[model samples]
Target: MRDLVRKYKDFLAVKGVTFDVPEGEIFGFLGPNGAGKSTTIQILATLLKPTEGTAVVNGFDIRNEPDKVRQSIGLVFQDPSLDERLTARENLYFHAMLYNVETTIMKKRMAEVLEMVELADRQKDQVKTFSGGMRRRLEIARGLVHYPKVLFLDEPTVGLDPQTRKRIWEYIHYLRDKEGLTIFLTTHYMDEAENCQRIAVIDHGEIVALDTPENLKSVIGGDVIKISTDNNEEVLPVIKNRLQVKAEKQGDYIAIQVEKGEIFIPRLAVELKGRINSMVIKKPSLDDVFLHLTGREIREEGVNAVDRMRVYSKRKH
Candidate 1:
């Protein structure tokens, strides 16, 4: 989207964000609650209009050619959109009809997608009888009924068990690799974002950082050394002056970033001696990158409807 902006009267939900996704690449939008990730996705999916700017999805203008844009893209929403009473095959068949797929090819397409999601055998069972993961897989199968070029997965794995989430990603990867489908997704899960080819970190209606996970973490320097000490007041300045490093005091601990944490630990051990209470060193993470850029943690918990309305209300006036 170029110069995209969404305003609810006065509240700015998305601020002139611009980015591109190449065909067949898995692109991710990563952020926390109230961060406008969903708002941006809505614009791209033709579900909402942008106050300013334009986007071209599969060569169709999102504003003037919304129908064409809708035709070329498939959307899997955060909430369950499946018909609980319908069998999986019936649901897929209904979607195929709604999308105007040729009747001759509908059965073939249903079989292909069902087999892709590995739900062909259970296609006769009601959706309510399937597990959460199975339901999600069927939803994805439904999205593929018309063979969309680009798929938008909004928080696709929310509320599922870890194993289920992993299985969902395996299917996602299979789609991109085997079917050559371009995938764009929004997620709050850090580990989930790592699976994407690249990610844009959004917060408070803006893109603060965008890059691959490795490159984003590299921007924070090297390994992270977190120290818990009883004498932070005494040790903070000593470490800074002697080591020429900056240390951030975070509540009960001092967080220091260095090129080589393991190598530096011996020096710290000898210099501080008995003064050190506890310390641990490890590699930087996407969470560290978010913290480095935003100075706050991207909330892992999903926001409720009331909280969403409250954010909207705050933005309006």
Candidate 2:
């Protein structure tokens, strides 16, 4: 996508965002709620049009050839889109028909996807009778019935248990490795974003940082030392002057990024002596990267009012 922008009346849900996903790679958009992840995905999937700029999906321009773009991609929305009254096989069959899959190959395709998601045995079960994990697996199977070049998974593992989420990721990796599918996913879960080959850290309708997980975490440089003291204001400057390193107050702690935290901790403990009330040391992680860039932790939150308005307007129109 090149300079893609989505405006909901006066509110810009998506700023002038730009990025690319390489073929067969698991590229992810990582951000908290209200950060425009869904709005961008909607634009890419042709469910919503951008206010400015455009994108090409599978070699077809989204603006000029929406039908072709739609044909070339599969989208599993953040919310459930499956028919609870229908059996799993029936849902996949409906999707196959909508994509105009050949009659001769439709059954074979449906069977293949069912097996891929390990839902072949339960294919005859009503979606409402299926567990949350099973329903999500069936949704993934339906998305793959047409075998599009790219798959967009919007919070594909949200609301599921840890074990179920792990299972879902297994199928995603299998699709990329065996089916050679390019996966574009949006997630707020830091651990989930780690599964991506590269991630775009978005905030407030803008891409704050984009890189591989390791690269993004490396921006924090080294181990993180979070020191909690009775008097942070008094200790922050002392640590900065004594260690000759930057120390910033994060929440109730003074956070310092340095190499060899294990080595530094001993010296720091000696330098501060009784001044330190508590201290914690750890390696850099995606959470740290987010905090470093955005000044806040990524937590579950409601969608932006503007994003909600955009969706409501789309439905009304």
Candidate 3:
């Protein structure tokens, strides 16, 4: 493993996780609520040291050389950390100052960043008045003020509409393509995870699977068999006890991974006696992989899935 992050759970905790991050590619970490996404990011970012296994960022051991590690990475937290009262330009300028960029260089970089995020016209507008998308973009601009080689983005497009989310994906590619920035991205959105060059599926503090999105979905072993049951939870165990492949309760429906979804659907219809409310069957998804790995839907309403798993080696938690 090139870079490793590890955790140990004792009487006080509920989970332990470990994983290796490959360099110079967009590595997407996927999991449900409380899947230790934050814990992993903290160790990799060198913000929280691990309990057991060590992490190396940019060839520097995090435990031995945290300062060097800190200098190599930039992090965009899930929450907006920008100063609400300050104008966007001012916020960025302050970050440039902290990085010790010369005054002329800071001005040039500030203008470039404001233009990059499409906020050149409103550079003087208070951050409090900017829209959610704009604030998110500005936060990203602030993180890049020092030109870090690796960017750790924790749900960068949280609470954004579809159009804005897609736009951020374009910016993510821009970092990889134009700037050659290595990215460690953790996202609950399946579409966002698919944009990565590779993905590592984490659940219960360990990687369940890792591969390219297309490859992972394609080789998931079976077509999906879906049955819209009255109570998805009640019937899942009954069906799972007899089925030879992976099965899960998805919302108001029961989904089975089998060789032929159509065939399984008919068999299920015969066995369940009553018709379902609705039924749909298709190939697996990263969402499906996440659910199957963690036993819960990725889009379950009203829960921050990422925060649930990230519960180790934390301070001020």
- The candidate scoring highest on lDDT is 2
- Could you tell me which 10 consecutive residues in candidate 1 have the lowest summed lDDT? 297-306
The sequence of per-residue lDDT tens digits that candidate 1 reaches over residues 168-236 is: 899889989988989999998887899999999998788998999989988998888989877898888
Off-target runs (Cα >4 Å) in candidate 2 are 227-255, 270-279, 300-317
Output the lDDT of residue 27, model 1: 92
lDDT tens string, model 3, 1-317?
23344545452221444455666788898765555677788877888767666767778888899888888888898778899999999999888887787888788878887888889999999999999999999988887878888999998988998988888888888888888888998887886898999998765556778889998887666787677877777777778776556777776677788887777876777766684777777888887777665566677434443453343225324
Provide the RMSD of all predictions against the true structure, rounded to 1 decimal. Answer: 3.8, 5.2, 4.4
lDDT values of the candidates? Answer: 0.87, 0.89, 0.77
Model 1, residue pairs in steric clash: 11-315
Clash list (residue pairs), candidate 3: 17-205, 33-305, 34-308, 34-309, 35-309, 36-309, 36-310
Cα RMSD (Å) between model 1 and the true structure? 3.8
lDDT of 2 at 193: 92
User: How does residue 149 of candidate 3 score in lDDT?
Assistant: 88
Model 2 has an lDDT value of 0.89
The candidate, 1 or 3, that scores higher on lDDT is 1
